[model samples]
Target: MNSKRSTEILVGLFVAAGIAALFVLAMKVSNLGDFTDDKGYEVVANFQNIGGLKPRSPVTMAGVRVGRVTGISLDPDTYDARVTINIYRQYDNIPVDTSASIFTAGLLGEQYISLSPGADDFYLEDGDVIDLTQPAVVLEQVIGQFLYSTAEGD
Candidate 1:
């Protein structure tokens, strides 16, 4: 009877540990593990191409993380990709002429939306569109251009 009780306790402890590990893993995956926080506001920017941009991807402004992408969709009239992002309320001083550009983290890393702020005194509203946008740079096109230029030079 003592052996049986010991085995039961071991199993229970193992199960509890697994549950705790799973919870930690989930929090990390969803980026909800952090304690200190600030509220943000949702805003949308349309793009001609939002190549491989995933939800929760960082939205950067002048090399700083201002927010993250909340959602993405398609426009019925323009067929462009509409990317929705949430900017922290404290960082909501973007000018009206600001533009968005799709950028990759590295040569083979993940992609993110980079916002380039303009000098306009007027700020963009919640639903305002970033008209001056640049799509993701095609790597293949860049390589081809490089090869073509080298051959011409030779």
Candidate 2:
């Protein structure tokens, strides 16, 4: 009876460990594990359309992640979508003329902000707004345009 009880306890422990490992894996895969406060500088950019971009979306420069979107709001004055990004302090050398564009990881993957550096000598500072921005591309609009053109040509 004693040996049987010990075996049962070991099995329970093994199951519990497996469950914990799975939980950690889920959090990491979903980007929930890196929930620390943004220890970086904030910059704003306005877009005519944002599509499905949400907070916490990655901001990449040369295909390397440099920051994350911290907030997204609508500007009542200009009726534009205002996106706030928190850039890591280490990437402080981004030029003032750098351009930001919304892009997808894959054909139908999640959207993220991509930054292209410019030749300007000045660097962007905290709270500065990026004037050069490209809005997200909506796939539906492209398809609609294609269908309309094809029907017209027929």
Candidate 3:
């Protein structure tokens, strides 16, 4: 009876540990919209080249995530990317002079949008356009530039 009770306790402990492990895995891998509170309105920004920038990429200001890229499409006439950003409404106080820049994690890392807020009392309203936007930098283009520069130096 003593040996049986010990084995049961060990089994229970292992089961509890497994359950905890699964919970942690889900938290890490799931895009549960876990980090954001979308208390803001959506706005559009057009870019001539949105290279490798996909939906759900973070829209950050000064390295802090403020919003996300909600949608992407092409303009009917100019063929430019129409990127829709959903910012938290409380931060709608972001000035109209805010500039958007596409940045990478590293030379061969993921991409996310960066926002640079400018000093201006005027802020953006719903449906407003953020005209100052940058597009993602393509890796191939960077490699090409490196090769060309190396050849030139040689």
Candidate 4:
């Protein structure tokens, strides 16, 4: 009876360990494990369209991630999408004239914001607005335009 009880206890422990491993995997896959509030300054950029860009999407600079999209809203007056990004404090030297463009990771991958720094010597400050912006390019629109042009040529 003693040996049987020890075996049962070991099985329970193994099951618990498996459950913990699964939980960690889920958090890592969904990007919820590294939650921290000190993400640094906030910057806003207005886009004509934001295709499938969600909150917590990465913000990259020259192909390197430097921040994440914190929020997205719409401007009722201008009818534009306002994207709020939180840049890391370590990358605070981004130029004021930097441009933000929405881009896809692959043909069907996730959408993210890409920042291109400008020649300006001044750096961006907290709550600054990025004036130069490019909206996301929808694949269907591009295909429609291509088909229209092809039919017109025929």
Over 1-154, each residue of candidate 2 has an lDDT whose tens digit, in order, gives 9999999999999999999999888786766655553487999999989888999999999999999999999999999999999998889999999999999889989999999998899999999999999999999998999999999999
Model 1 segments beyond 4 Å from truth? 1-30, 33-39, 147-154
Candidate 4 lDDT, 1-154, residue by residue in tens:
9999999999999999999889878786756554544558999999999999999999999999899999999999999999999998889899999999999999999999999999899999999999999999999999999999999999
Per-candidate TM vs. native? 0.73, 0.76, 0.72, 0.79
- Could you say which candidate leads in lDDT? 4
lDDT of each: 0.86, 0.91, 0.84, 0.93
Clashing pairs in 2: none
Residue 144 in candidate 1, Cα distance off native in Å: 3.3
RMSD of 2: 4.4
Where does candidate 4 have its weakest 10-residue lDDT segment? 30-39
The regions of model 3 sitting more than 4 angstroms off are 1-29, 33-39, 150-154
Residue-wise lDDT of candidate 1 within 1-154, one digit each (tens)? 9999999999999999999889878687757753237656778888888889988899999889988998899999999999988887788789989899999997899999999999999987677777888988878888999999999999
Better of 2 and 3 by lDDT: 2
Greater TM-score among 1 and 3 belongs to 1
